[model samples]
Target: MKSFYIKIKSFFHSIEDNIAFYPALLSFLGFNFAMLMLYLEDKGISAFVIEHAPPLVINNADTAKTLLSFLTGGIISIMVFSFSMVMVLLNQASSNFSPRVLPGLISKRNHQYVLGMYLATILYNTFTLVGINPKETDKYQLPGFSVLIGIALTVLCFFSFLYFIHSISKSIQVNSILEGIYSKAKTRMIRLIEKEKKESPSFPDTSDWKEYGSKETGYLQTFAAANLINICKENDLQLKIIPIPGAFVLKEIPIIKASKAIDKELVEEILSNFNFAQGEIVDDNYALAFKQITEIGIKAMSPGINDPGTAINTIDYLTELFAIRLQKNDDTIITNEDKSLIYINTINFSELMYQVMVSYRTYCKHDMTCVQKLFIMIKYLLLQQTNNDHYHNSLISEAKYLYDDATANVENEEDKRRIEQLYKSLPNKRE
Candidate 1:
């Protein structure tokens, strides 16, 4: 039963991540609200409004029908245009930047809400239009107040359209995208740092721990951490996640190490808590942001694009991220208050730094601007707060790699001179 519950929760999370969730939900709300207005209309809401304020009610059946029909058509047109704009946005982002960014943009709640509002407005007006009759003898039964509401909703949508345009334009800008990614990555990192300081613990030797293979094959994206914690606490077992978040896992591969051998049923329940999917979502995994930023930098440096400015911006964000990372320990350990339950062996700081710096050294080494920025970025990280010598050594090592690339590939005498001077200026012990 717990396994079934986990699957249900997992399914709901996937549904919630989809772009259509909000639109479909708001559409249902719109339908229900239309029925509600009809109920109020049956209760003589139009008569009450007419008695108090005559101008607020729409008594003429032809006027109500015409207005609702016209607004409904107009809303449909607006929705069509909005969807087209979104498609174009996705295409440009995927082609020019990186395809990974599309998930972030697609899962944007604001855009979803705007599109949902458009759908809701359309459905509300269309349903209200169904009930209007020219030959109804009673003016109070005309759904006059309801027609007024649809008109008001249309006016609100006009404003929403304006907001949507402003927001979408800003979202498409590369700076905004970078900042958003940076902010999210920083938040996730900071949370980890706090956890390390407070609840972290040294675990007993796991060399003898029983290894368990995954039953499914896909990229391990989100781990249901809260649910896993409950299961661990209740079962009095410790779990170690083998592959880091954002890693592709295969069936019958050892992806978890349990403190003891467990029954098949328990193993299935534990594995069900891990969500595997095709792509990465940045929110659950900060590593994806690092990867996304790196990919954007690589795309910019590609010959077809030849846009060095974007690459420089990406370097700036990565520099700040790395600096924050210096404050992190080499390992990530999540535990309950008693300092026992979960041990997540994440990609260590050294490995993450090596991966990111190697990519920059590979792709951006030819561009003097980008390579020089890499030199300075390494210099800045070397000065940040860290308790580990290995992390410091990693930065120094990355600097040496950048220097070697700059020396071999950089052709301009002046740029080579600058690289020489920059390499000389590194922190003395780091040499």
Candidate 2:
């Protein structure tokens, strides 16, 4: 039952991440509201309201029909224009930023809500217009209140459209994107730190464990750690997960090791707790935020784009994220109430630093400004470092690599000398 609940939770999380979820939900609400209005009109509720309504309120079917018709056309145009702009923005983001960021942009709640509002207004107006009886003389069935509501919704949507434009403009800005990624990464790191600080039982030894291979191949989006821990506790098994979330695993590759051999059925059942998808989602896996930020920096420094300013801004945000990561623990362990059940592997600080810095060095090595920025970033990180000699050494190694790249690629003697000076000033340079 716990496993089933976890599956349900994961399913909802996936839906929440989908771009169309909110819009579809709002569209359904609009359709149902239109149906309810029609029912009210048939029951003479609209007729009674029309009789008592003020002169400004649309009481005649012909006027309401014309108004709804106009609104429908106007909203349809707005939807088309908004969708076109969204497509253009997406294209710009993909070319100038990173394609990985497209999901974050697409799943933006404000944009989705605005689009959904437009859809709701259109659907409501269309359905309300159909329910109007222009030729009925005995009892006019004009949905005046419904028409008024539609008009109000249209005005609301108009304002929402304006806000959407402003929001999209800001969303596509490079600095905004980098800050968003950094903020999310920092939040994830904080959560990890809090989790690590919690008291938990030590993991049992599993040196003689039997390894279980996964049946699928893709990015390990997420797994039910709590459920897995409970399962291990119930089965009297000690498990070690070999791959972290955001890792790519291959079919028949060992993903988990157990204290004892398990049957194929149990193996498949255990694998069911893991979710693998074709692409990475930053919300589920924080490490993907680092990857996305790195890609954005790379794209900014590319020959075709040649926007070193944006790359430098990205470095600033990454430097902040690395500072937060520096103070966090590297291990991931989960246990049951009183006993250790699972141990999972996660990317250590040094590896994450290497991955991000290497990508920056590979792309921005020729740009002296970026090279200098890298040295400064490393210097700031060095100050944030604890007594972890290994981490400090890693920072020093990264600095040397940045210096070497700048030496080989930077042509101007003055710029090279500046980078050399920056490298020389780094802590532990002699080591």
- Write candidate 2's Cα lDDT for 1-431 as tens digits: 76799888976776665678888889999999999988887787766765776553576667778888998899889889999999999999998898989888888888899988988888899888887788864445567778888999999988898998899999999888887777777887888777767744577676778898999999888887767777776788778888888889999998999888878877887888888877777777778888898899899888898889888888888888888777776766776665667787788878999999999988888888888888999999888856466787889889988888879988888997898789889876754
Which candidate achieves the best lDDT against the true structure? 1
lDDT string, candidate 1, 1-431, tens digits: 66467667876776676789999999999999999998998898889999999899889998889888888888888889999998998899999899999888888899999999999998899889887888997888799999999999999988898899889889988888888888989999998888778765777778899999999999887777777887788788898888888898999999999888789998887887888877777877888888999999999999999999999999999999988888887666667777677777678888898888889889888889898888888888888878887888888888888899879998889989999999888885354
TM-score of 2: 0.92
lDDT of each: 0.86, 0.83
TM-score per prediction, in order, is 0.95, 0.92
Colliding residue pairs in candidate 1:
none
- Assess candidate 1 and give its TM-score to the true structure: 0.95
Worst 10 residues of 1 by lDDT: 1-10
